[model samples]
Target: MHKRAQVSVEYMAMVGLSLAAFFVIWLYVNSSNASIQQDLKVGFGKQVVTRLADAVNLVSVQGSPAKIFVEVNNPEGVVAASPSSNSSCSNVEIMLVMTAPDGKTTEVFSPVAANVSGDLSFLVGNPGLRRIQVEAVDFFGSPCVMLSG
Candidate 1:
C-alpha cells in the first residue's frame, strides 16, 4: 500500500509541473502576439500618411490648378480631433492616433514636404475607403496643396 501511494504522488507532482510550464509558455506567446499586432497597426497608419503626403507633393510640384485623386485606407483607432490645424505651409502634418492592446494610445505624425492644408475631417477617426482630392491652390497669398474627401 505504501509503495503504491508513493508512485501516485510522484505522478501527480510531474503532472502539476507540466501544467505550470505550459501555462507560462502560453502567457509569453499571448503577450508577444499583442505586441506584434500593435506594431502592425502603427505601421499601417504610417503608410496611410505617407501615401497622402506623396499625392500632396505631386500636386504641389505641378503648381496651381494641379489636381489628382488618391485612394487610401484609414486604419482603426484614428482620432477625430487629431492633426491640429496648420497655421502655415511649413507646419503642415497629418496625424494618426492608435491604441495598443494594453490600453495605451499613441499618435504618429507624417510631414508633407510642400505647403499642405485642407478639410480632412471625413478621414479623421473614420476607417473606410477614402478617395482624397489633392489640389494646388493659392492660400493667404501663399501657394499650397489642399486635401479633401
Candidate 2:
C-alpha cells in the first residue's frame, strides 16, 4: 500500500509539471505574436509617411501638376495630415487612427521630412483603396490631396 501511494504521488507531480511547462510556452507565443503585430503596424505607418513625402518632393521639384495614387489599410481611417515645423527640416505628419475589435481607438502618428507646400486632403475609413493627387496651382504653391474612391 505504501509503494502504491508513493507511485501515485509521483505521477501526479509529473502531470502537474508538464501542464506548467505547457502553459509557460503558450503564454510566450501569445506575447510574441502581439509584439510582432505591433511592429508591423508601425512599419506600415512609416512607409506611408515616406511615400507621401516623396510624392510631395517630386511635385515641388518638377514645378508642375502631378497625381499619385496611394493605398492605405488603416482600420480606424486617417485622422489628420498636416505640415509640422521641425528644428532640422520641414516635416509632414500623417495620423492614422484605428479601432480595435473591442472598440478601442488607437492613433498612430507618422512624420516625414519634405518640402511640402499648400494643403493635403485625405479621408478616414475601413481598410481599403485610396488615392493621392498633387496639384500645382501656381509657381508658389503645390498641394497634395488624398481622394476617396
Candidate 3:
C-alpha cells in the first residue's frame, strides 16, 4: 500500500511539473505574438500613409477638381493618419502611436506627406477596409490636397 501511494504522489508531481513548463511556454509565445502584432500594425500604417501621400501629390499636381478614391486595409489597435504637425514633405515624417508587448507605450511622430489639408478624421481608428477620397483644393491661396472618407 505504501509503494502504491508513493507512485501516486510521484505521478502528481510529474503532472505539476508538466503544467509549469506549459505555462512558461505559453507566456513566451504570447509575448512573442504581441511583438509580432505590433510590427504588422506599423507596416500597415506605413503602407496606408504612403498611399495617401501618393494620392495627395497626384491630385495636387493635376489641379483642382482632380480626385482619386483609394481603398486600404486598416489594422486594429491605435491608428492615426494626419498631415505632419508642420511636418514638411522634405522631412518625410508624420506622428502616430502604438503599444508594445512590455506594456510600455512609445510615442511616435510619423504619419504624413504633401501640402495636404482637410479632415483626416475619417481614417483615424476606423479598422477594416477603408475607402478614402483624395481631392485637390486651394488651401490659403495655395494648391493643397484634401483627404476625406
Candidate 4:
C-alpha cells in the first residue's frame, strides 16, 4: 500500500511540473509577442520620420518659395500605391508639419491636390539653418514617415 501511495504522489508531482513548464513557456511566448509588437510600432514611426525628412529636402530647394512635390511610400502593406509621384498616388492621407523661426508649426493634409510652394515654416526664422519636418500618415492614422531638413 505504501508503494502504491508513493507512486500516486510521484505521478501527481510529475503532472504539476509539466503544468508549470507549460505555463512558463506560455509566458515567454506572450512576452516575445509583446516585444515584437512594440518594436514594429517604433520602427513604423522611425520610417515615417525618415521619409518625411527626405521629401522635405527634395522639395525645399534653395532659399525661396519653391513649388515642391511629394511621394509617399507605406511598407507595412497598410497603404496602397506607396512612393507615389504627383497626385496620381491617391487615397493615402498625409500631413505636412512645418516649424517657422518663431517656433510656430503649420500642418497640411492631403489631398494636396496640387504642388505646393511657400517659405517652409522651418526656413522662416533661419534661412541657412532652416528646419523642416514633414509627416505622412497612412489611412489608419499611423505615421508612415517624417522627414526633417
Highest-scoring model, lDDT = 1
Computed on alpha carbons, the lDDT of every model, listed in order, comes to: 0.78, 0.52, 0.67, 0.42
Candidate 2 TM-score versus the reference: 0.60
Sort by lDDT, best first.
1, 3, 2, 4
TM-score of 4: 0.40
Q: Worst lDDT window (10 residues) for model 3?
A: 84-93
Could you tell me every candidate's TM-score relative to the true structure? 0.78, 0.60, 0.71, 0.40
Clashes of 3: 6
Residue-level error in angstroms, candidate 2, position 85: 16
Q: Write the per-residue lDDT of candidate 4 for residues 1-149, one digit (tens) a residue.
A: 99999999999999999999999999999988866754553354345435554564454333233333444332221222122332232323434344323345433344322233222233222322223434433313322333234
In candidate 1, stretches whose alpha carbon ends up further than 4 angstroms from where it belongs are 1-7, 80-91, 101-104
Off by over 4 Å in 3: 84-113
Candidate 2 lDDT, tens digit per residue, 82-102?
532222223355455544434
TM-score of 3: 0.71
Question: Per-residue alpha-carbon lDDT of model 3 for 1-149, expressed as tens digits?
Answer: 99999999999999999999999999999988877888887787767767777776677678888989989776665445555332222323433454556666544444344566555555556677989887877666666676667
User: Can you tell me which runs of candidate 4 are displaced by over 4 Å?
Assistant: 1-5, 62-149
- Name the better of 1 and 2 by TM-score: 1
2 or 3, greater by lDDT: 3
Clash pairs, candidate 3, are 94-109, 94-110, 94-111, 95-109, 95-110, 95-111
